[model samples]
Target: MRVSLILLFVSFRSISGFSQEAEEKKWSSDFSLELEVENQYFSNKGAYANQLQNFLSGAIKPKYNLQSADGKHLFKVELFFRSSLNDPNRTHFDVREAYYRYNKKSWSVSVGFKKVFWGVTESNHLVDVINQADQVESFDGEEKLGQPMVQFNYPTKIGDFEFYYLPAARRRQFPSDKGRYRFPVAIAREDIPFVNDLKEWHPSFAVRWSKSFGNVDTGLSHFYGVSRDPLYLGFNPATGLDLSYPVINQSGLNLQYTKDAWQFKLESIYRTTERQSFVAAVAGFEYTFGNIRSSGVDLGVVSEYLYDSRGLLTFSGLDDDVFIGARIALNDVKSTELLMGGIVDRTKGTQLYRMEGSRRLGEAWKVAVMANLLNEVSPKEILSNFRTDNLIQLRVSRFF
Candidate 1:
């Protein structure tokens, strides 16, 4: 792997030199950097927090752009590195995006690692958002995919429709505390062929089309792939085998409308495999004040719903059968952004809400104090079924 990476670097450098010398002029570039910090807490310590008492993390990301001296060709790359403040196995580096493009008049093609989410919903817990997929990582995490892929776009009267192909890729997997596998199992020596032959390759692909009518945007996408790695089927230690499942085959549709300070979004996805199948959907809305005095005085609210029939709740049981919640933010008032919300369980009627307040310390930094109260109302199983926890976080974010 190291040798291949070195060779790739060398090859790109050589090509760049030749192009630089042959072309009449050279290209210019731009750069930017961003940083974040977060602190978090969990309700079910047994399920959510298996490591220490709480979790904290920080990340620094940088992006670079390259363009031809004649301003015709464009190349861009992005990298993100995250480090756990206390957890042992939570540190990792990732290539968020690395793609290049040549702009003409009407068409463009991007090839390499890129960010593509299929929804416009606020409660993206049901859809995929590379940057903010997981709620627990709201302060300092991302759900990014890095693959060798190609995407082409063409503009029509309505909007731009895109076609994408991923010839081969190895998607990153995040393992939960219960039993998560970060990498594929190695072919044991006993199972190896007598001639020492091993196969290690995977392919994945996707196609999507989107269009907008007035302020409404709608899209549909499909994805299919076969991977040599083992999918998280289920946990079974009795057979000395981590469950193995087939590749991913899925499809989804997204619809959204944004106009006059009002926004609405909807997303639905269906994932099927030999082991199980599940369908998830999310609906959300937000209304801002167009004539508000301060950016902080605007009104904000978001809600989400989720359902999974695959019987596997990701991120622990936290991704349970259903979730409904709301968020409200009051800006510039007492220099605070008060966010209060709750999520309820359908079967048990258990609920949780937030008692948190965040204030900006400066242009690039903010501090928050929060309390997650479980079963705020008087309940029968207050102690056993419900409890409360407090979380305090001071975040300093900088953009360049």
Candidate 2:
């Protein structure tokens, strides 16, 4: 990664040799900023110390991009910082995207930190494994930390191919003692353990081929190297306990079929490690009722099933579960939308309910609302730690 950075600086520092030198050498830049302030309201008291009922947080995200006239070379940089008045772990910074891309007629190469997503399911993402989860930001796993990698894209008549060389894996952050949805014991963050002596500097590789056939889209991917999910190593006398990131190989498949007002999606993965192997999948379908009563309102119903072969030992506690949800789009000038969903464990009858909605206040202002509720969490389940962590979030964003 260091070598790649050095080469990137040396190559991109000079703009004279980027093109044939005959065309007019032109470069343009764009800058944007978003300011966000949010609050969380918990219905019940926390299970641990320092957990509050109401927490306030704010964040700033700024991005800048530069590109040539012919769109052959491009540069982008984005930064994020959040400050919390209650929890220290919620205050963090991330370099979401700081990458340079060189594009040709048939191929493109990108290097540096960037975000990548891969999955077709609405409830759970079993195939998206490139970036680490930014757990401190959101518990739904929708937010992600940017990953440092070198990506290459090739397009052919059959399919589009992508190759990735990922390095410098980011460790997943946990809530502090003062934060919400915390574990029983505090885990030390410094000097964490990793198998195979690779640590965070392990070099990983991935390849994906995607193609669309008629009304169906498909993607086949394979990843070899470090696993983003951590396994519990054991209790320490001083630090309590820690997690170990092991080396693994995972192959995944994502499929989606769309016909009229119906959509079917599937995402599955087969993963193997030195000690264990397992398969996890999420499959579902969505049906939409468009232009109901000519009111320009669209309503959709969703249902999906989740399964993991690890059973009780599964860290996700989703061994046999089902997700049911609905979506509403107002189709108004304000661009309002709402989504509500719940995941139910078939074995223990526990459930997690979530609802999220957003509406534009005007051209440059927007407001969003989210709520998460837990019900009947069993002690044998992993989500028992969050039984009393049901909370609601309200966020307002100003764009400039």
Candidate 3:
């Protein structure tokens, strides 16, 4: 925590200095702030393991950007803060991204904490391993903690290559004792363990090559480092049951093809550890009907198959599953959109349904609704633990 604070202070100082210098040189500088309020409700009553019930949370995000006159150098900082009525884990702060970047003709370098996303599928982000997931913030793993690193990128005729040297690792955060979506056995912060002797300071590295050919965009990546997903090892002599994040090497590939109103996507990864190795993949396609019947509405159908070599023993809960969904876009002034989807576990007859809708309330306000339902979840399935956690969420955001 102290190291994070020190780095954050240094980043802020550097941003301030760059902003002043850029202002003196009349370079472009921008700033913005946004606020959001959210309410969540769970359908089932709390069990002995459950914590909070209904909750209200609010967040604020502030951003600052500075660019050099020649556009060769840039600095950006984004800060996040959220407070919740019941969940202590949700009432926290984060430095989402703070980086200094230098770009030249065909190469670029960046230093500081940042977020990197690498995936092509919508249901699961199998290739995104650089940043730790902020699990307490979202169940879908959409929220990520910024990772401290130095990155370099080079573009060539063949493809674009990128490399990263991460100096530290951030542990995945869990919900507090009073937070929703928690495991039956609460994961105390102090009980989390790392396989590496050097712990958080252990260095990690990754490289990727991406290219586009006609309508196809593809990327191949290799990551050698600590696994972001922790393994729940039952009962330790000292700390009771503990969670361990193992060191791992992973190779990933993601591909997307866009042709007319059809889009196809694939993401796959092969990972190895000292004790085990596994392979996982997700392949899917989406077909859209644009301006259907001249009503200025677009509808899309999506289907995907998820496979894991570990089968029922996999922790991902996506092994041997099928996902199907639909998306509707009003294409109106408010930019309304709705998505409904479900995943079916073929082996156990378990299914999970989800719905999400969003539309702009005004020029500065946006409202969104989301719901999740679990049905016929088998005890052998991982999602059975969450069967009682079916929930509905509503969010409103205001932009400045």
Candidate 4:
């Protein structure tokens, strides 16, 4: 922390020495703050292993962007405060991003925590932020892991590439705690390991390339990293385990084309380990027309399909199912988008569908709601494996 402050001071001093301009502008620095709130209910809270019930989770974030007059140096910092009403253990306050960059026309180097996003899509909520995504894809095999690091990037005629040397979290094996409940009931909890020697020890490397022609854009990205030693798990006895998981590797391809009011996008990723691999893909399209069309209305449709290899769910106690879903966007009601989707399990004959929608209240705020229903339709399966039949969630966000 002290070193970072020193670096920040030194960088500013160096920037102040550059040739001054005739005029200075306050707008050269930008700052913004935002808040997000979520209200939710879980009918099968029991199914999720006694998780949160109806509750609200919220986060407050502020960010600052600073640039030197010469444009050769740039700095960014963001702080976040998040809390959950039902799950207090999930509360956190930290520096989400803090980085300094040395910039050139074709290349740049950044040191500290940074976010690198790939793909060409109007809304990349899922694809952005490579460091924090799906648990199956971003594994610590442990508890909390991730943050910033020293990263370098270079762009060529063909594509752009980046590398990061980060301190990764250690992976730990989770144990189960079982006990007898009221008269014949059984309750079990996941026991995670916690070790003292654990340090920020994971490092990563990533590369991405994009090419565009006419109205179409396509790109590919790959990331690889190895596990660090003396990793920390959640439980107290975190040592004595060999960090022998396969070196994590992942790669993906994405394509998007837009001509006038119509757009199409496709994205796919393959996650590989020493013993097995998994794949996920989504294809979507949208068409916007209105206002000038005179009716003051716009309409669009989106669809996606997902397939999870059976191996990915083995240790997670999750379902290996195929999912298909679609969404409808209606501009008349303040950019309201409705989503509906379902996942089917081949082995269990169980099916689950989720319904969700979002609407913009203004330029800076939005609200979203979601509901889920799950059922088993085939060979009267035992409910012992089932936890809940429905769930509901509502969220509101203010963005800067």
Top-TM-score candidate index: 3
Clash total of candidate 4: 11
For candidate 1, write residues 1-400 as lDDT tens digits: 2322443364357446746554456556678988877665553443233434466788888887777766567767777777776543445565656777766678888776677766786434344422212212332123544545678888777667777776544422333342111112322312211111222234556677789888989887777664323344443455332434255677888888898777887888787766666776766676665325754455565556644454333322223323444444554534666666666655546565555676766665656676665564333222222243334454556767
Q: Ten consecutive residues with minimal summed lDDT in candidate 3? A: 232-241
Q: Please write out the lDDT profile of model 3 over residues 56-147, one tens digit for every residue.
A: 99999999888888889888888888999888777878888888899998899999879999988988889999998878788878999888
lDDT string, candidate 4, 1-400, tens digits = 3433554465456445532531353325678988888766766544434444565678787887777667877778776666766544335555556777899988888876555666543222223324542121112122222355677787777766666665553343221111001001221111222222343244566667777877888887777664322212111233322223345577878888898877788777676666556665556666655453666544454444434343323322123445555555565657887877765665666676678798999788889888866676443332223335366778888988
Determine which window of 10 residues in candidate 4 has minimal summed lDDT.
175-184
User: Would you give me the overall lDDT of model 2?
Assistant: 0.85
Worst-scoring 10-residue span by lDDT in model 2: 14-23
Q: Per-model C-alpha lDDT, please?
A: 0.54, 0.85, 0.86, 0.54
Instruction: Give candidate 2's root-mean-square deviation (CA, Å).
Output: 3.0
TM-score of each: 0.70, 0.93, 0.95, 0.67
Per candidate, the number of residue pairs that clash is 4, 0, 1, 11
Residue 97 in model 1: shift from native, Å?
A: 1.4
Q: Which digits, one per residue and each the tens of the lDDT, describe model 2 over residues 268-312?
A: 999998888999999999999999999999999999999998776
Candidate 3 segments exceeding 4 Å error: 232-242
